[model samples]
Target: MSVRQAQGPAGRGTRPGLWREGLAALRSGDLRLIWLAQVVSQLGDGVFTLGIVVLTVELTASGLALSGTLMAQLLPYALLGAPAGALADRWNRRLTMVASDIARGLVVALLPLLHLTGWLHAWMIPVVAFLLTTGGLFFDPAKNALVPTVTPAGALVRVNALLAGTRQVLFIAAPALGGVLAAAFGTMTLFWIDAASFFLSAAILARMRVSGRVPALTPGPPSPRPSATPLPQGGRGAGGEGSPVRGHLLRDVQEGLRYVWRVPVLRLMVIVGTFINFILSPLPVILPLLFLTVLGLGTAAFGTALSFIFAGFLLGVAFVGVSGSRIHLGYLTTAAMAVAGLAVLALGAGPPLTVIHLIGLAGGAAVGIMEVAETTVLQRESTDAVRGRVFALYESVSQGGRAVSVALAGALSDRVGLRAMVYAVGALTLACAVLLALSPPVRRLARG
Candidate 1:
């Protein structure tokens, strides 16, 4: 594979040049189809979440009931992420994704059918949520592992930016769309729409022409020692022997863990990523309290303020896609974390509404930068053979951190006061940024 030099510092190029580079990934037909499928499926997901929330509220008045639904959605990621990721490497990637979508689509459609038949029950809501996310556990690793194969190596960052941008846009748009549709029809209608979206996504993925195999690694960037060699097509056995079928699933999972621990860059990334997720997890719980109590704002203003975060995320992804390649990923990640810490600190200061909105934007942008940097580097660093398992371990720990942190944040805020909680989060984030900056391995992760 040939290498493309990183452009000079991001803003040195003309505006047109930046825009061209940002949009270049869309020129691949396979990526376009995948992007389209993602847009539809994510929209459906947003609707499904809203519908579940509405249904849960109607079922019970207790807040714990609502929290249980969230826990149900997160459980699969913690329990099955590593195994699912290993399976993605072992199986055909496209087929795994398609099967996941189809399975989820059918399961989702059952909600409305159950309602129509007078069999819908409150207990079923959390069950359905768990099952839906379980399918995603399999789908995500396959999709993430497949992207590098279909896209040109140089455009990988740009492609990741495009996909992340879509999520941000949908984050802002989906609620309003779901609300309007729900008011016009019922919440059950949202489920039907969500079901159809999954089917459509499956149909789109089915049309892609690639073989859906994790191809053997060609000579490119240096890989971490020992994991540098590619596994046979089906993966290796416990004794490093070739097997037409994958080795024991547990062994495959263990290999992924060992690879990350052996690779300095990946090990650091996973550590930092988990810490970052924990620090930021409070936003969802604290933001509402901050707006309603600290800022003396109404629900309408709170919603408006939330949009700034997603908008800032869009801006941040655009920046990375267009000009971020000029900076070493380690330096970029450290800078972004510093900015995020400052934004959180600003929030803790109890400024007026406009200032708070700006903080949200800055914080969101910082998160976007961190996300793209880590994902792109992870893809570049790991071999295709173990990529799925690596992603799975990272994802599993990240989700667990967020889940535990959110619960801890709520408890800590209750004890220390919300402002103090915010201050602590900001301080810890800055400390982590400093640590990243001081690490030699992290700073050395320069562009190829």
Candidate 2:
């Protein structure tokens, strides 16, 4: 358990240094495998999303079709996230991740063949996307909840930062690569590659050490050695006094909600978070509109701007990983939202495209800072009993927020100018930050 500690502001080392902690986790053998599995899976996801977009364009050339496909990709979090998370607590996390990966690989592997044989239809894209997303509903929370199990105490920040940073980098690179590969060979190639990534992810995750929380086990005859037996507690086998309440799926879902509702910080965080999620959208529509219609800039401009955001985000993660203890995470989150607001304003102000890219870069960094800060807080604070459900609720609500944004964007994008839409986004983001600063409950969060 001994590892290198990070230096605090007063010059004393307080927590584990990022690289040292990461290496420690890697040496343990579980965290590195989990990290690798996620990285590979995300690469596949990037290509898969790109391939789908290309296939959609090839099939129908309709905006409505594209929107539907996008929704299919996101909505499963809203629909099944709670149930899936509840199940994660009931099942073995490693097995859940492995099964989900294997299932997804099998499903995604067939998509390219369907297209090659002329069996793929435009309607089926959303259907397949929905199924894949369903797998994600199970996979994501399980993966998240596993971090505390695998990572050492006080090093959750480094572990979470690594996970978040990796995803952001992949998100930036994956789509572009997928697009190129799709154009060079075909969308089928992208699909096959993505399928392979999932299979590899599954193979790696299957070997991880943590068994995670399991279902309620009935007490049997007492052991002769009283100290050896584990009492059932909080849907897990913990050493405790009385038998814990055996939670059904519905009850588990309720317990997650109750925990959030009772915690002032989590309650307020989720509320403001829903609004942030609504406006701070990396919506599929935003980039295309910026590149093609609003800015009238080519893909090169779009690519540059996109890269700025991703790189800035990764940099921000590195910053947090190194200096998380020095900053107030709640304040960091508020400031990040404010920066996003300014980025929106810059986008709408008709500034030079280079200036716009710079602003986007800064905004991306702010978001990266916000993401790791908030997640570290949550991951550090939450107990294993409710961690999976907490993540599930957050995902569900965030996706719901995105749905609201999507609906607004669709309904208003044609009625109003894109500039007007950008302005509204900016204004709402600022308003959310203002509300966050004003809230007494959120302020108290930092003290605890």
| Highest TM-score scorer | 1
Q: For residues 71-109, what per-residue lDDT tens digits would candidate 2 score against the true structure?
A: 888888888888888887666778888999999998888
TM-score of each: 0.92, 0.86
Of candidate 1, the 10-residue stretch with the lowest lDDT total is 235-244
Cα deviation of 281, candidate 1, in Å: 0.5
The TM-score that candidate 2 achieves is 0.86
For candidate 1, write residues 404-443 as lDDT tens digits.
9888878888888888888888999999999999987675
Candidate 2 stretches greater than 4 Å from native: 1-19, 116-118, 214-246, 282-299
Error of 1 at 292 (Å): 1.7
- The C-alpha RMSD of each candidate to the native structure, in angstroms, is 3.3, 5.5
Best by lDDT: 1
**Whole-model lDDT per candidate:** 0.82, 0.75
